[model samples]
Target: MAPPTTGRLSALLRRCASAGALSPGAQLHAQALVAWRLPDVTLETDLVLFYCRCGALPHARQVFDTMTPSPSMHAYNVLLAASPPSAALGLLSRLLAAGLRPDRYAIPAALRACAELRDALLGAALHGFAVRLGLFSNVVVSGALLGMYAKAEVLDDAVRVFDEMPEKDTVVWNCMVTGYARAGRAKDALDLFWKAQVEAVNMVRDVRAVPSVLNICAKEGELMKGREIHGRMVRILAFDRDVAVGNALVDMYAKCGRVDGARAVFAGMKERNVVSWSTLISCYGVHGRGQEALRVYKEMVSQGVKPNCVTFTSILSSCSHSGLVTDGQRIFESMSKVYSVEPAADHYACMVDLMGRAGAIEEAVGFIRKMPMEPSASVWGALLSACAMHNNVDVGEIAAYRLFELEEGNASNYVTLCGIYDAAGRSDDVAGLRSRMRELGMVKTPGCSWVDVKGRACAFYQGSVPRYLRRRIVWVLDRLLEDMGGSESEDGHTNIYYDYELIRP
Candidate 1:
């Protein structure tokens, strides 16, 4: 049989690559070699792309290196995109050495590789190269550069890139806003979002920006801002039906301690995906509504939605928090046997937590021994926490020893061990642990909580408040307590007040 024409073969290779048929792509490559002693550059490039798409980097390199004349910039870009960040940088260097000028396409691909690798130096060098080549202003290249800087957590550089860009397209704006959110500069992200709104940029048109801000609100516990964004989404008649947006909204509300709001969003969604289901189950789990979480999981399975690893993790977490040991164990086994989902370390950690929480100390230790892989810090931490809760000093010490070896710098592990010793009346051991911690210069991280008031977030730290604001804050709190019929204990700590109207004051 005669091989197809070059054009026909190129089309076939594209289809195989798109379909991710590695074996078929390799067979096609062999057939092309047999058909043409010296295939055209286009065919050769196509073969490289096919191999790259199939993750056959070695074959891609072979095709690239064996080309009679050096490959085109397009070929280099394809290889760069296929390679890891370091390899991509190496390819860019080779392109420069070969006297091939990188065009708009090649520069952005290399920048993206740098971003993923978080190599700030390499990314900055690529930015310089793009500027020298006069390709920096290209919309795509500028967007990639901004994203690279953002991923590297060089927010100032990202802002500079944004400010210098001659044209600010929606993609550019989205990148900057998302970057600020990811860097925990939530105010900056919200400011930019409102700025975009004032400029009438139709932010809802950029589907990516909404989720980024929603995530920021979630992290900062800014429920007011989150609801405002949700209202905007509804007004625009946008993202109400988008599964990703819906999932984000649900997560935001859940993280803010508003399970009812999250549940409302979940219930109102016209369509739901695995993420939507998982987020809702996670919400219930976190709020200690384990039975409700398990119910949702069953409903998801009944609706034919396939649960992924995250879904299992959430459900297992629910079981652990709810003290449903038997249920957790059943689900853990079913993950591999019934669902064919291999239990990752997280799943094992959850299982250990479940056993520990249920006071099965010996079983939990035995479970760790039976794991296919080495137990991680989380696994040991779970055991240690259980020991503290149950006053099991022996097991607690063992878990603490493993934890100290695993996470030497985590002061919380040492603190937890000290607490266990104190509870067991082992003052000597507790003092020794504290002395060791002090010698090692370890300090416990301060506990902090955040509340959103009138669209602003206020973070409060344990045992500390700014002296300047202390008087005014105390006066306001006194008024709030008076209004709520609250009384102070002998130690001057306020007793619980069920009325939430105190928040309004």
Candidate 2:
């Protein structure tokens, strides 16, 4: 009940930090201060760590800064680990200025801040510093450096660090995969996942790779490979026991156009969280199963799994896809009033799309005008897309004007506005817009599509097909058109989505 001595008080502070008992920890500090019983460095470190763990940064800093000889480097580590990027880097500077070399813990924490800030120069400097201090040999330090480079989009440096590491562990592997993903190298991520599995044949299989691998499979729509990975996960390990793996499985199945599979995985999971429910709802929403998504949302609420912001976004997106105007309106109203979840930009954008798609363009505009915050680019883009769909040239022009201000370099906005004018027979306006786009050096990006053939995923972009494929694919298409008794205009044209050829190897 009482901290009778310094040693006992230090232990109690650690216990409070572990339990995140902020109130009791604060009272103990007050008692220490009033009694003029200043704690030793270890006790001071414990006090700072206690407050940091409890998210009381102000209190942590106060105790840390007031130390007679300054706090230990370890004390600075605790604060930096919990502080924001700017604050963490500031503390790291203080550590350097104090002329104390940072240990493995402080280095990784500082590297994490660099990754978040995307400060590649500082991260590279830290990498050099770690090498000089001999922490470069530490597996954790290597992994942190790899993660920092990956997050900064410097994949070459990340890969070099990853390859040079004497011992590769799950942490570094996940970091590499996620780095590839964040850098838009989805195929590279999948290749690394495959490579890791091959290497793990002689070592311990890392179940941690499942989520990242599954996500890559989802993005690529490689259902066959995803299923194969699922089998391996089940046989080599009991991966279903891990909630994160289960959630990724659901997401992967859903993203790859298998709602039934996603639903089955959700049903089989022994544990569920807000993410589990939200992922299912999102898959259903994405697939235009608005009614099912709504049912799931109701079930989630009834089961006392309070809907989070993601749940609302998924459900609102569902209504937008299905044109469920009334349901969307009810849910949007309830977000702030009943649920106390303020509508984010995403939610506001979804509402505009919902109303605009349902042929209530005027109402959607009015909603945008009365929004609590300034309309984001997404909100205006949604309105512009809807106007293009409905051939509302005047409203389309207004939305396009706002979008040009918001995203001056976005070619899609210009293309959509040009389409609206073309649809309304405004040839002069279309020509002028085309001229403007050309002057701005804004060429429309080619559409890309992925094809999965016998476990191999191939990506093809418009107008970038091989000459052999184009000829053979056109010939095959012409034959199919002749067989189907198709119209003359449709014959001999490659499918717009892809210029695919089905030649046997």
Candidate 3:
């Protein structure tokens, strides 16, 4: 969110506020009061929040002091929310001592502070305060309490808080769902979603939480479940009115390897925005359909829905994946010239990947050199991967060493560089790299894979084989080692990154 701007005074005030230039800020405050006859609570509160963000709490209090004469509950909420955890609770105490009752806004802000601090004692006390004020049923206040307990990693307490609530809404459901997701309790989160569906607890009117459900189904490759939700939306509500739900469907169908389904959903959308176009382009990109993604992008431009940063990233990635170098370059160059969209780091990384994947290693290096900003790890990693593909040991070393500084603990960098050296028959260099890795206690990262079977999510971790696959694994165990160019260890597995690929939908 951006800070609110007031005509001419806000720009200067925003700068002074962010820089903690108290003298200049005071001047702006005086100018604001003189310029506008009515007191601008928004500008005053903005100054307080900016000051708090800059860690100039004393100056924030000075703004607060001026506000106290004609204070707004919104102003109090903004200040407390912006404040550091301990300081927020202290300010709440000061307000309570002055015989001022905390409103719903104030309670949530204070509870948020408790969440950040993980101060259970004060959290419980604030819960009592909220109860005394009869705000226990207030959705905002109850959501905050749930969030506070969840942040402390106390799901039991969070669930207890949820159960005791006399009312629940989309916000409460989302919080509980997010809490379960964060705690690695995906089953619990899914169960909660199903329970809410069965009870029809606001699901009929509020489809806000549907995207999260679709996201989970997509991640687990549960195409069946995603289709069920899509059907439910069609039957129970006018879901086509919202763009977000449509985007989620496109994403779900795309990740489930049902590109036609995604396209069909896109075609049937009654309303479309930039995000919808971007999601369609990304869906194509993921399935290695660069030409189709480019077609969609061109169609988006033709329809006057200008591409945003995300759209460019998706299209550029599609080009990279399918080796559409010419299209990728033209688009990257046009990003600033025609569209006025500044190429951010992701865009630059995509360019490098495009050139590198096309075996234009020198062009990729040149692109990095010409980048306005410092090359990110993605940029260098793209170069490194290309180097590995073309067996360009010299350039690979350069990218690898740069990555070493950028991501020190990533064992994959060392592994890639070592692979390059080994391929070049540089025995001494390989020994030296191995010795360095030993000195640094570096080891390869383990891999894991899993798939969804019906409604259940089955996970396979590193160094473990599924019992059902034991026979197949034994048959290929030796041949797999030979293909990977690594000798098998005593445990019947090669020294390779093995297991589950990330289930991104």
Q: Estimated TM-score per prediction?
A: 0.82, 0.83, 0.74
In the range 190-234, model 3's lDDT, one tens digit per residue, is 788778776746766667667877887787777887898899888
Error of 3 at 180 (Å): 3.0
Candidates 2 and 3 compared by TM-score, better number: 2
lDDT tens digits, residue span 270-366, model 2:
8899999999999989977798899999999899988889899999999999989999999999998988999999999999999999989999999
Candidate 1 per-residue lDDT, tens place, 116-233, comes to 9888898999899889989977989999999999999999999999999888788888889989989999999999998887763555566678888999889887788899999988
Q: Rank the candidates by lDDT, best first.
A: 1, 2, 3
* Candidate 3 ranges with C-alpha deviation above 4 Å: 1-94, 103-105, 112-125, 131-140, 148-156, 182-184, 454-505
lDDT of 1 at 181: 88
Candidate 2 has an lDDT of 0.87
Best by lDDT: 1
**Which pairs of residues collide in model 1?**
none
